[model samples]
Target chain A: MTKPAYEGKQPSFFTTNAEFIVRSIRHSLRNVETMIMAIVLPVMLMLLFTYVFGGAIDTSGNYVNYVVPGIILLCAGFGSSSTAVDVASDMKNGIIDRFRTLPIHSWCLMTGHVTASLLRNLLATGIVILAALLVGFTPHADVWEWLAALGIISLFILAITWLYAAIGLVAGSPAAASGYGFALLFLPYLSSAFVATDTMPSWLQGVAEHQPITPVIETIRSLLLGGAADEHAWFAIGWCLLILIGAVIWCTWLYNRRAGRR
Target chain B: MGLAIEVKGLYKRYGSHEVLKGMDLSVAEGGVFALLGPNGAGKTTFIHILAGLLRADRGIVRVAGYDVTMEKLRVKMSISLTGQFAAVDDMLTGTENLRMLGRLNGLSAAQAAARATELISQFDLEAAGGKRVGTYSGGMRRRLDLASSLIVPRPIVFLDEPTTGLDTRSRRSLWDSIQALASQGITVILTTQYLEEADQLADRIAVIHEGRIVASGTPAELKARIGEEVIELLNEEGEVSHTLTTDGTITSIQDQLLMLAQQAPPNARVRLRSPSMDDVFLALTESADSNSNKEAKRA
Candidate 1:
């Protein structure tokens, strides 16, 4: 009799993760509606803010510069929100059970979703920035500054995508996941994305100035405008790191619980 | 052959509802073993526990000689599970799904592709191999799901109701696949609610009812346990009006017919039939339920 094929061989960690990553990327590409929304919605919002609200909010005509960072973050948020739906559907569907029975680590499923979302958002972010440039948004940053700005954007994307992945793990269904993720997209609107925090009432300023998005936006704006907001940079890094760690822990716990335990 | 799976004193509960209660079972290394039960009788739960997809509340479950809870990875390495529902990725093509699972099973990219092609043809999915699974019919999806589990053949396979929703032709095709797997010396543990399925395919059958294995034996043994034959008295409409058990001997059947002649109407016809798995299931489970009730009342 022939021996079973899997005996005496363990799949390499890299190969296993690569397979899942490719699977997720393929799914993301094939889901045309999600791909379109991730790019178009943010671009549309950028256009709306730059054209309609630009003159009323700021007479200096630099509203596009101030708003681009916020729109970039919103783009990442929109792209990452689909991770929640993807993860929720994977869980609710029977596919997760099949992965659980495999010899590889099951948490690799989340890694696939997160990595794919990060890549997709970065592409969408790039497209949104190009759209901003076309609509009179100018930046005075050097090569180093551009790289630094991109690093922050990527980090922010990674953090928020993982957070959405964790949400997907716990959501009862894909629709519920979308609803929960929608609530998080409003964070940028409530922060210092559109106008100066000083223009708001004192009661609302505390929320506008102190939230994570404000620090992140401030850091990005400073980078692109050729200034170093050192304190905001530290706060931005701190916030992204904190969210990344917490969401990773939460996702792992939720996955293990759902897959059953020893 | 040695036992491929050994389980004892398995107990599982979801809140106050117990799904598996003191279930004990074992399977030899190379044969088809069926866990026969009705819906909600915990057959799927038992299969899940054995596959290490669900942890037993308290039990000693050893698969391929490794303890399930202590060495889950090893247990996973030994078995592939085809769940009650088709679990293929609907977004990926059938070939892509198989190739991805192959890659996860440690096959190189080239090898995975080659194996995917082999399986696609083997499962008669050559024409639909490039199509997304969402477009496939239910039977086609089920075939791909089964093929996915076989990408890297494990020593044992757990099939939880593999034919539950399949048509007659698809069901027959799957039965052939199960037989082929067992013939290759891989132990197969399948659960089903269909008596004919268990009777037709299994080398041995274990009847599960209300979270316990009520009886386990070869198909013939189970049928003989009820009686060798059943004598049915049919009415004018050809419906069974009365039935009596016989030992399949001339005198035993003669006695039954004589007794029936005294009371049965003139239009009633006598028919002798051999016992089937259906009779064993109804007789065994009904008695088990009543006995448990009696024990409860006594307590």
Candidate 2:
């Protein structure tokens, strides 16, 4: 005979995380408003930059190619910001307390949110790239270069989404989480997302060039357009790895502390 | 039967406010136990500590023979908690929620689906089972929450204020569900404010007041300790105007009624009643309050 359903045995770790992932994905699908905003906002910004400002900024007509990489990152940032709100909402609800009483690792809660955000943001990134193509954005890249560009984008999304998930765990309320996440959306703008860093004033160039978002944007741009991709790739990978590790550590410590681990 | 839960000198505090002050309690296996307390009496805190959701400041807590602090996973596996609020996910359907918990508890997908269907029918939620829980009524949501927790019945179940805001009919239905669990030999620990709920459901009741148990006994034992009969003066509004305790003798009852008759108002009528659980609860908690106050003054 088959064993009873409530045999009181610990499930495998993969099954635990997979259940949470399914839950998070269902929530993302039901939340249509956030999903639409994540996709539409970046497409609108890409259109505005390509049509209105592309001519004045670049008389050579290569501005759309230059700006698509930054628009992709912006789409990622917008998509990942909702993860903070989702995490904070989970924390505030009694459902989290129920999960804590179960025999699974509570860190699975944040991992589920991070993984869902990564997939959602990737879809939004794909849509934004499609919109850029329609708006005269061109790139001279082989299939290998395309794979490299996609890899960097996925890594950046994973890192930022994890960071936002940690911020959600620390936030006392969903509104506060959204407000904090909104502050992070400004980092890409201050970096080399829209305009080149060299075009800014000398002092402002230092601020724009040194931030993590700048190297990532620069590396994606170089890979897509067949520019020199040696140095910027290392810096971009290093920053994403650093953020991902730090965020994972922070989430583990915070979840344990709040749940009152011995 | 073995002791399902054993707690001794359990103390918990938030900043300067002590929520659970040196409280101790125990329950035997395969019975219904009620923790009766008013709001803010630290009943939820005590339940959280026992479920391994919160750490006690200083205590020896063992659930199902495993120390809560030292063996958290074992204690967690041994117990299922339905918290004060309905913790069902709003986005998921009732069936989906139950299946998710089943999966989390290590059930196979087919087994989880079967269990979800069984619980949904057992809870009489067939009409609302397919809809998202956000659209469910408060009582329906609570039933779903309880069902989710029972996807895999552990040895012990802790329901913290399970039916606090439910209507009378809904409360009755939930009581039936709880009774079924107890009949299955699952040690069920529940907390409530209603004296009738405790008297109707619990095999034993513990009255907690100001972070300590002021009284503990069976329903009949608690009622018997107060007296045999009580003579009460009821006003026009059916409220008790005055009360007097009496032994089970005709003379003692007459004497008390005679004394009350002189002081009774024109709109007041006499009521002869048996000693009730309400009287025991009031007498126990009130005397506990005065005793603590006296201790405070002496110190």
Candidate 3:
């Protein structure tokens, strides 16, 4: 009997999935000049916040320490929209339709895209971190705690990146993806990132306190600062999980529907 | 073994408009079947339904003896489709695209690489294989697209207007590739508006018009149906001469032509013939349109 093509060549789950991810990362990283500009944006923001506006914010401890993690998160959030733009551009350019005819798993395309975005976000995050450290801001968390914080934040970023990707898939064009991203950026600011939710009006404060970003930021802050654990961590994880599941299901349905039409 | 592809009473609708109304077709294994139709004739819909990309409203569709709906994966594995535009990633090189597809089709890494190289050489794309697809000319991109489809040697292939935008040389190259595949016993179902494409490549041709199969036969059979000679007479009086010349008077003309041929033994002989495929196409569409118009008026 003739052996099948996959015989003796079965890839491990990680390797199979990682191959696409690596391809996407390589494609994204090829444009190093643009990424350098993206890296600079966060570093410049960190400097402006630390030097110019640090005195105005009434944080008792170092302002850089208080804002560095938030800036890193912001950088991740801001830069993630490019992933959506890339997806939308691909859709517009007939690449998605080409991918549909291939034998790859449907989710592989999105996985590759999200992985690339995460890699770029990590690079941008590193630049911000270096800039913060250069200005004497040190992470208070232990190594494990910092790792844990990083893990949670990465998960959150991945979840939201998928959501943005779905938006991009549905958006009319790449410009629309950027427009949607601009709308999403306001959510983090409304949360507990730049200001306390208590400072807002009661109605706005209620929304900010209960929204998904608030718990996520709170959880990360607690982990990084060695503060008391809050119930918001569970809520944040639940929200991320829900969003991840819902986005995947909805996007897959749309993709299948569109594929069927073609 | 009943048929390579079988469709029975396939129907599809979009919104309030019905695109396919009970279309049916079957193709024997290892045959080059050409589907000829004008635009909006629902040929693409039929192909999509058979490919398992579209679900028919009501029908039975099977590819390579597997039900398209229940055995979608099997059906998919048995066939490959190439549409009008080349479906390839512009960022990736030609070799990379083929290798990626090979891996997706379950080839080992080494196997994928070897298969990619083989396809590159086969398609005469070796010189351009290392360059990104974005830099490839139209013909090179089309060849790469065709190469990508052959990544996993499928038994049946669906090509929808594959040579629409190609230059003559590129079109001829594709025709050669298609013939090579078919000669290897791969069943091919192709749709083309270019009549010559159908005439040259298709062993059998089916012309579809207004969601219906207007005519089907071997190219010789279809051309034979058109008879041997077409005489074009110039009418000096325009519409009046045309109306008078074709006014249900063919019986008399037929008799006269027979009598004249018998009486005159000349070096040159004139024989009357039926219309060509282009003529048949024009007549069918024109009649279908007028019939629908009359029905609308009556309604």
Candidate 4:
């Protein structure tokens, strides 16, 4: 009853993932609001912090240089939330079930989602960087510093996107996923991403110095503006890697457990 | 010549609720097998097990000669599942969705485009294919969803409540597509709550009640199980009981029924009609309900 042509031609694992990646990328491209949110949120934040709050804050050098790095990391956070919403929708909409019934591996689909998010984050970061340059934000990064900053930002996006992907799986709806994701967008405000830590209350300064986003923001700011980045650079990479590894493990474990039970 | 799907000793439960208890089914290739059940009768559960979507607590399910659990990949390769909901991507256009599935299922670039074009015309989605599915009508979405599942020439297809929530006209259109598939020798297993749909489309029908098949045979054979003549009695509150009798000819039966209606309560009505798939379904499930109720009283 089967055709000989379609037989024995199971799509290779990598090919399957590549196809899913293409599908996810297509969906992301069509979601105009999420695309806008990805670029606009950070750009809006850049303009607001550069103009509205630039007068009140004090940085040793140009405020754009101080704020651009922070806004880029903030952009990554906002963009990862879109990953959460996408995952939640796929789960609730029966598309995941269709994927499950197919011969394709579940990890391939998850990887596809993460890959699309990485591209979105990359494009969003590029837009912010270009916008920052337009506003006279100069990056003094040498070769190593440039490589290190780009590596750190990519890792940061990968780490946060994986974490939100897990959150999306557990979320009941896309709205709930986005609601939980809203917390990620707000994490920057509590860190040195916006105002100087010293200007904050002494207690808040302690939190601002110790939180995860602070180190990454400080490291990028140092790299972009030509300063010593020894401790901050390692700490930022460590945090991003730590989150990425931990999240990948957790999401894989959750997927296996759910697949087993479901 | 061989069975497209074969199942035995299927059992599933959600805590205390047993959905499919030691149930079994076999479906030959190249025909529509309609599973009819009232809500919670485990029709969906059975299809899920066959499609390798839900794990059965105990069963040996073989689809296209592949064990549903042990050789799930093989089973999946030979089958396509269109779930109760339209599972196609809302963000993609109808053509894009079909092309995406074709590529995901391992067709080459040109093959995918050709297949997508073929399905677009076959499903009559030429105009709707360009529009985002988020803006599609329910009928258009369902047609596209069905088309997406047929990216390859799978020997078997599982359609779970495929016509659910659609208007009559849309449902008829979907029915025609199912008929078209069967005509191409594609085996179809469809779970439906509509008896008329079963009667109209199924070569064979199974009535499921309380997680087990209460009756199975050709649609006419199933109706014949409840006898040819059905006497429907409606009381004042509009509660109806359909009973089959082997009493004399149709006219004689109607004569006796009219006399019985005389002693009945006010506004009572009695009608004599041929047994339909609905009658067979109701008869089997009603009997199952009463038998369980009796056991409950005894316990």
RMSD of each: 1.7, 2.2, 4.8, 3.2
- Candidate 1: stretches off by over 4 Å: A1-8
| lDDT comparison, 3 vs 4, better candidate | 4
Residue range B111-137, candidate 4, lDDT tens digits:
878788888998898998788899999
- Candidate 2 residues B1-299, lDDT tens each? 88998989989998899999999888899889999999999999899899888889998999999999999988988889998889899999999999989888878889889999999998999999999999999899889988877888788999999998999999999999999889888899999999999999999999999999888889888887777899888888888878888876899998987777687766568888998888988989989999999999999
Native contacts retained by model 4, as a fraction?
0.49
Q: Which candidate number maximizes DockQ?
A: 1
Cα lDDT tens digits for candidate 3, B139-207: 998899888878777888889898988899999999999998898888999999888889889999888
Model 4 scores a C-alpha lDDT of 0.84
TM-score of each: 0.97, 0.96, 0.87, 0.91
Model 4 reaches an interface RMSD of: 2.7
Over the stretch A2-87, how does candidate 2's per-residue lDDT look in tens digits?
13544756778999999999999999999999999999999998888888998898888888998999999999999999999998
Give the per-residue lDDT of model 1 (tens digit) for B246-297: 8888999889888888888766788888988988999999999999999999
Best by TM-score: 1
Give model 4's TM-score versus the native structure.
0.91
Can you rank all candidates by DockQ, best first? 1, 2, 4, 3
Per-candidate TM-score, first chain only?
A: 0.96, 0.95, 0.86, 0.94
Q: TM-score: which is higher, 1 or 4? A: 1
lDDT (Cα, tens digit) per residue for candidate 4, span A1-262:
3244433247778778888899889988988888998899889989998988886785444687788888999999998889999988887887776777776776677898999999999999999999999988888888988888898899999999999998887677889988988877778899988878898999989988988898999988888788787898788888888999998898888766554333
User: How large a fraction of the reference contact set does each model reproduce?
Assistant: 0.66, 0.66, 0.21, 0.49
Tens digits of per-residue lDDT for model 1 on A1-262?
A: 3434433246899988888899999999999999999999999999999889998999988899989999999999999999999999999888888988988987899999999999999999999999999999889898988999999999999999999998887888999999999999999998999988999999999998988899999999999976777999999999999999999999999988865522
lDDT, candidate 4, residue A65?
77
Give the clash count for each candidate: 0, 0, 0, 0
DockQ of each: 0.60, 0.57, 0.32, 0.46
